[model samples]
Target: MLGAPLLEEASGIGALGIDLTSLLVYLINFTVLGLILYFMAYKRIIGMLDSRSERIRESLEEADRVRKESEEQQESMQKALDDGRQEGQRVLAEAREAAERYREQQAEQARAESEQIVSRAREEIKQERDAALESVRAEFAVLAVSAAEKIIKRSLDADAQQDLIDEVISESNAKQEQD
Candidate 1:
């Protein structure tokens, strides 16, 4: 009779296995709730962060492009300014050289004109001096002839008279030259 009751107690041992199955179902429910929360909250936050990062990257790229263009423009402008300054200096130097050449030419012309004027004045002075000396010689000869005619008390009478007057005039001229 004791062995027969012991076998019946052994059959009730399978009821403890049902408790483990119920614990497994509760673990599956907890895992599903955690996944739902992540999809609703954390996914939207990650999307917002990604869009903001893209905008910032594009803005930075545009700024870099603008800066590069500005530098290129400045370099070209600087080169143009330098070229203009060099051209201006070249023009100024050319102008100064031309001015100097013109001045030299003018000075040479003035000197030539002055020489011509002096030469003309000298020629005129020589001519006047010759005329004055000739006039004085003519007057002296007339006076000497008049004085001799008065002293002789006679008029010239042809060939003999001409011969005597020539001899006397030539001798007097010679003595005057010697003295």
Candidate 2:
């Protein structure tokens, strides 16, 4: 009966077409092929991937550095523009102040010159008035002497004539003062 059960189990396995020896051999060959492929190409592929990743990291770092430098340059340019505008305004203000000063100086000089001209004209008029007064006085004296000579019809002594002329002149001056 034991041999009979063993024979029946073997017949069942044969009916299923399952062989232990063939399964074992297939497992061994698959393991060896996997190991060979890993040794031949796996390390080189991993190395290439690592190098590419490092290159990408370096490129990103360089781009960041360039962006920072560009920002700094923009700030510097803005500062320079602001300073130039302030300087231009200052220069314009100074120029305006200088022009105002020059105008004031010119006006003052013109006023001084005009005053001098008026003073000179006044002095000239005064001199002319004095000369005319002297001429009239001399003419009046000549007329008085001629009238006295004609009224008297006789030659008077020089001292007596001079006294008469002095009395007449003093009386006329007194009359003018009272009026």
Residue 56 CA error for candidate 1 (Å)?
3.2
Model 2 per-residue lDDT tens digits across residues 1-179: 33343223554457554668878999998988878877877777787889989999988998998999999989999999999999999999999999999999999999999989998888988888767755665567668887879988987788987877777667656765687
Candidate 2 has its poorest 10 consecutive residues by lDDT at 1-10
Write one digit per residue (lDDT tens) for candidate 1, span 1-179: 34444223433665334456567877888888778867986687778788888888888998998899999889889999899999999999999999999999999999998888898888888888767655665665566556767888776666765666566657766876798
Clash number for each model: 0, 0
Count of clashes in candidate 2: 0
Taking all chains together, each candidate's TM-score versus the true structure is 0.53, 0.54
Model 2, residue 82: C-alpha shift (Å): 1.2
Task: List ranges where model 2 is wrong by over 4 Å.
Answer: 1-55, 136-179
Q: For model 1, how big is the CA root-mean-square deviation?
A: 10.2
- lDDT values, one for every candidate: 0.75, 0.79
Top candidate by TM-score = 2
